[model samples]
Target: MLLEIEKKIASFIEQVDSSFVQELFAKIQHGKMLRSKLMLAICPKHPDIITLCAIIEMIQIASLLHDDVIDEAHIRRGSPSINAVFGNKNAIMLGDIFYAQAFLKLTSFDRNIAQNVAECVVRLSRGEIHDVVMGNSFQESKERYFSMIEDKTASLIASSAKSAAILANLDSEKYYTYGLNLGIAFQIIDDLLDVFGDEKKLGKPAMSDYAEGKTTLPYLLLYQSLSQADKQKLKSYFRISSMEAKEWISEKMQEKEIFEKTQDMARFFANKALESIEGENNLKLEEIIKNMIYREF
Candidate 1:
């Protein structure tokens, strides 16, 4: 299923946007190279080989390009980001290339499938905007944080699984619901890594969100749960010049309880993902969701 899907996507992309066709093709190929390794690492026998491969490739490219713009990132996957290499203008163009490619591939299916993916795309874009707004304002509300993370990260994953179900023509709502829960869990884990992750492993700066004044899950949870004195101290740090945000983040890291609390929250989301799929008997999907609980950055 994955392989066929990849071929179809490649065919569609090559046909729709011939100007950047080769570059887009190369991008999807690299995406497939990574995904093939991941699929082998996790579930070698995952059904629908052609279709799954194509969707994963499409998703990976779409995400990497968009994320580069979002992070204004200098590097990605251990290489210079498209923006850094080609300048922001071309980088944005490439991101558009990916988006157009996704839409082109999506249109090959029914209206319902296109609608689902279009909606997810809108959500993803809105999520990105929300994060940018919150980061600029240093908003730390938990509800806002959840909404931002859900749209920015999880929506794509949810769309992937739901689209798979759409391709399979499955009538069960279990796929969409499970995919959504899995996306939420996935974002929670990513948020955890934003604090605890290694710069080398993450291919980005550690605690970069703090440096950017973004209030991620850990920051929000700490801000909400900490005592007034600590909150004031933290807020003071945040309000200060650049050097102090780093100092405050370092100080916050010393509080072990806060880290554990964040972990528990991630676990809670992962559990909810499992609950969403309880008794579905789709062993492959179940394994995928369960493995998300322990996925390393």
Candidate 2:
């Protein structure tokens, strides 16, 4: 199944006339293709399923290119990122190529499908903007954080399932709901992993998000549970990476039950995803949600 999606991506890449773009594509590592997998799971046997997955994958990669540039991310999926190796210009331009290719293909699909996917791109960019602004200072607003993740991450994933449903003549709304929950849950789990995941295994530093000035859910929740002096101390530690700070955070995490609360929140969304698709009896979909919420690193 993934092979077909790869072939489809290759076909699209082959259509581009630039060797640089093609070569750049070769250099970047591919993720689990979670968005593509969600689409395929919804409309597995549809003739256009592979093409749809390919198009979304292009959009996903394009967004990531821009994200890495924004976050100054040097590594992606355990490999050196395009911006890290080739330069930001090449990374940004290659991303444009992918987005242009994806949009070009979208024109060939049903107008609703095309439009639905296009809007997600708008939200994705908006989400990116919100993330940048929020990162400028320590933020504790749960409302803002959830909204940002929905736009940046969940929007595309939701659109993937929604568009597949549209194409497959299935209940688009149900899948959209499921996708939204899954996307939000996915972001929450990512937030948890940033703090709890092994730095070596994740190919990034643990607490990287907090150190970078973006207060993730765990930190926010943990912050709420702290006293005034402790809160001030945590805020002061923002973007400060030292053994002492790490030790302080580790002791707090062990003492507070914050991790369990964060996990429960992720599980809440996971359950919502399952509830949204109650009668579907699609074990693959269930497994997707379960694996997403429960995975370690």
Please give the CA lDDT of all the candidate structures: 0.66, 0.90
| Winning candidate number (TM-score) | 2
lDDT of candidate 1 over 1-297, digit per residue (tens): 445556666675676656655664464324324333323323344454354445456655776777677768787666777777667677676667667766765566667767877888788888888877876756767888888878877776666666666656664256566666677777776777877777798877667766666777777777876788988776666534466676666677656366777778877876776676677556766566567666664
TM-score of each: 0.82, 0.97
Instruction: List the candidate 2 regions with Cα displacement exceeding 4 Å.
Output: none
Model 2 misses residue 144 by how many Å?
0.3
Off by over 4 Å in 1: 1-13, 16-60, 236-244
- Model 1 weakest lDDT span, ten residues long: 34-43
Question: Which RMSD values do the candidates have, in order?
Answer: 3.9, 1.1
